[model samples]
Target: MPPPNERDPLLEISGLRTHFSTREGTVKAVDGASLTVPRATTVCVVGESGCGKSVTARSVLGLIDHPGKIVAGEIRWHRTDREPLDLAALSPTGPELRSIRGREIAMVFQEPMASLSPMYTVGDQLMEAIRLHKEVTKDEARSMALDLLRRVGIPRPEQRFGAYSFQLSGGMCQRIMIAIALACDPALLIADEPTTALDVTTQARIIDLLRDIQAETGMSMLFITHDLGVVAEIADEVVVMYLGTVVERGGVDEIFHDAKHPYTKALLGSIPRMGAGTRQRLTTIRGNVPHPSDRPSGCPFHPRCGDAVPGLCDVEEPPEVVFGPARSARCVLHAMERSVR
Candidate 1:
């Protein structure tokens, strides 16, 4: 076997299994999902709604609520100033992780209005988050808040600071969410489908802003989205998920051009190509994502995979086949290709 190459990793999730207990049965929201976010790189987690992209992001923050817990895996957080931490082993309710939540790792939720409070002024909310992780006074916090709002491309930062979230447009509110997440200058930012509700033009601007911020701050980001178009625009690395597992992962160029797994190919094929005939229909994956409760026996995506070998793919799960240092896929097709060598 080849020796593993060195990694410039910030957050590394390995064999993560997050399960939710219900009256009916346990749902494995994230199972054996592994990916690495290197320093100053944007790793986009692309998959369908229930494919565990969001759940995996939540798991890193220790945000899985009661009845839902991380049963297994290691979330290794490598800090430059200190030794690496296995977050999965830490107590979710403990103060250590709480301190790390905003100070080092911050999250930008999907819905802006829902994430921000209606009662408090935008300034207060921003200042509160800043003060929580920082020792700055209220005035200092406000100054920082204004700077953040300005950095996020919000117009008239002074006026907008005192305004309520309800008063702002959807795009503006989303910008506020990004500012709040950036309050502490977190080393890692987890943006969970931040542009899902924005208009195309607004979405483009938000993406550009994020890209610029990353370049300036040198902070790594784990951006979750179902849109491959957004992925192409932002991702340095791409991790494709299916059901609850990472089906394929590699450089953005590798994933878009030289896809490995059939599921990844299906996903790439689904994108609307430009310059095609006006009536050209976009390709789509067949079959719906299987319910977590009635889990498939073998490969989670075998049912929908066009190239699945009936007897094998439907009977046994495939191991992740490594392609390069940081590229691989969990598909029998790759397994077959490797065995042929």
Candidate 2:
């Protein structure tokens, strides 16, 4: 855990809300989420699909498209050399934010094919990203691009640079995505399910690559994934989400060893294990995650929580209960007990 005396935070998100409009109704994709990323620290946001993990990451980069907007809150970006900027208030089309999107804070999406243009060669895309953010000639950009590819562990990067997205495997494409994300030497990187589609071995390699790069570059990362195993592998801090709200958040040790939220415990229990005498059925939470328009009243997880108290959890939104200097949970079990004391 980082010391409390650390004065500078690379990224600070508070009460962030991203809402989307639809003919049926509005969807609160990200509802009042707050988090912080200390410089050079990795914080992982984990939740089931549709629980706003990706939306939160996208919102940080001000990448939400039409019909979706950051309705409230502040995203403070504190650069090493410049004054802090409020990202939430920045105009999407303005040059001020456009300058920071790739150069200061980069993002890697789930599907590289969707993010990478099929019409452009891999070298061209990487060179474009590098040249766009930095004052470099075409030849220098190409050389830097090749160096980034090699840094991401792509073999024979000079040869691979001429290849297209379709020519590379899923793992290779993800590496290329990482290379592009790192082209400008960003201070923070948002990786949204960066290894979801790859095979297990490839996923391991990607995770290792991220760790190595982070160590070498001193870059903070907000890694979004649903897999607890992945969180365990890469996270210094973990934020557990449910129905677009953060249920619990803490350091890796506090979360895995002393999980306070019932939802967190249930998620940990659901992980399949090896070497059990009998093949026990994996435990699962009873209900599906409610739709955005139909979220449960009070606590969003009340309907699915095995240990939910009848009146408290169902009637009132729980306050964040601080267990330690850096650990807290939003649950009635903690809130009510503290109130009664």
| TM-score winner | 1
**On residues 2-101, what C-alpha lDDT tens digit does candidate 2 reach at each position?**
3333335899999999999999898998889998888889999998998999989999878898899999999999877667799999998889999998
In order, what lDDT does every prediction score?
0.91, 0.90
Flag clash pairs in model 2.
none
Best by lDDT: 1
Q: Residues 202-233, candidate 1, lDDT per residue (tens digit)?
A: 99999999999999998999999999999999
Q: Mind sharing the TM-score for model 2?
A: 0.96
Candidate 2: list runs displaced more than 4 Å: 1-7
TM-score of each: 0.97, 0.96
lDDT of 1 at 245: 91
